[model samples]
Target: MALTQEEIRKIITPLLLSGAKMLDRHCPRCGSPMFELNGRVFCPVCEYREKQKKTETGDVEKILKEKLNELASSLPEEIDELEKHLRVMEKIIELLERYKKLEGVK
Candidate 1:
């Protein structure tokens, strides 16, 4: 069956609000509650890892550096994917804004 615009919004609005609440609620790591620190949401334990010193041997550092360079070489592809996603999101936002304007809602 075909759905009306009001029906579609009634079905989607709650789901979107719930999803946003869930995304805003959790830590990316450990799935614990995140606290805002210095304008970033982070798990307290995960943030503490930044203070730990690396203890790599010469051989380990050499291997790590090689792996890092390999990963760095792939960054352009990663950046392209992010740019594509951002473009898609921008289009979605524009469409939503137009819909809201038509609906006479802010």
Candidate 2:
């Protein structure tokens, strides 16, 4: 859905206040102006949600990898406990791989 001018203002005001820079580029989907925040450029009306989803997905991937690394470093000497830890790490690895594949689809 295309955003009305007032809707765009509602979204852009806080971004501008927070130091988001208005860009010369326009959104291909909506023809609205784009802004850059923390090096990510997007349209408040069009691409903002897409950008946010990508950023959130990236965060989740990072967190899963970190957890897997932590589990790897904490492996137990006891065979039973080691198996449990390996199972958890395997799940995390699977999640990370799934996310990587989803990103490729995008």
Candidate 3:
């Protein structure tokens, strides 16, 4: 079985970027490294005679990062609103305490 172009990309791109020493030559079909076994240049990463790929890949990590950034941007506003509510509740508690103190002597 031959690997698809996407499979070749997933395996090779990271290795190249990390500057790993390549032992095999790149495949003519998908640009992935091909290993030679028994004097045969067989590609385990891509089908032979394959053309340029037209498939679209998803960037899930990028989308998640953007969503996190949006959530972080709104967090300060949420914290501010909570702080305002806490201050109001504190004032109400203080007023109730004062009313109770006045009633104690009446």
Candidate 4:
């Protein structure tokens, strides 16, 4: 007996969703290869799911620029700390010179 169209569809639907494409990677749970669905990894057989691929997500240059800006914004605090350290060193140097004079040491 020939299968009805609805019966064929019911059978084929699941197979199509689970079919492995050439671009598919691997299933996170079963170690079987995974297929791509809407840019995310999908393992139809095992029902595994991975979120969108990382490489497909963001602008590299924009990310770099944001990091650089973060670094740049923190520079003043670092410079202030270095300048405070320099002042302490100058005070130590002055005291050393005074001690040398008192001891008649060059």
- TM-score for all predictions? 0.27, 0.63, 0.28, 0.26
lDDT of 1 by residue, 5-42 (tens): 56336543544454422235655565544455345544
**True lDDT of residue 15, candidate 1:** 41
Kindly provide the TM-score of model 2 when superposed on the true structure, using C-alpha atoms: 0.63
Better of 2 and 3 by lDDT: 2
- Clash pairs, candidate 4, are none
Model 3: CA > 4 A from native: 1-77
Pick by TM-score: which candidate is best? 2
lDDT string for model 2 (1-106, tens) is: 6777676677878888999999998788887779999998877876566777899999999899889888988999999999999999989988998999999998
Error of 4 at 60 (Å): 56
**Number of clashes in model 3?**
0
Sorted on lDDT, best first, the list reads 2, 3, 4, 1
Evaluate model 4: give its lDDT.
Answer: 0.49
Who is ahead in lDDT, 1 or 4?
Answer: 4
Off by over 4 Å in 2: 1-44
Candidate 3: residue pairs that collide:
none
lDDT of 4 by residue, 44-104 (tens): 5443111222232234434544655554455545778857655655665565555546445
Number of the candidate with higher TM-score, 1 or 2 = 2
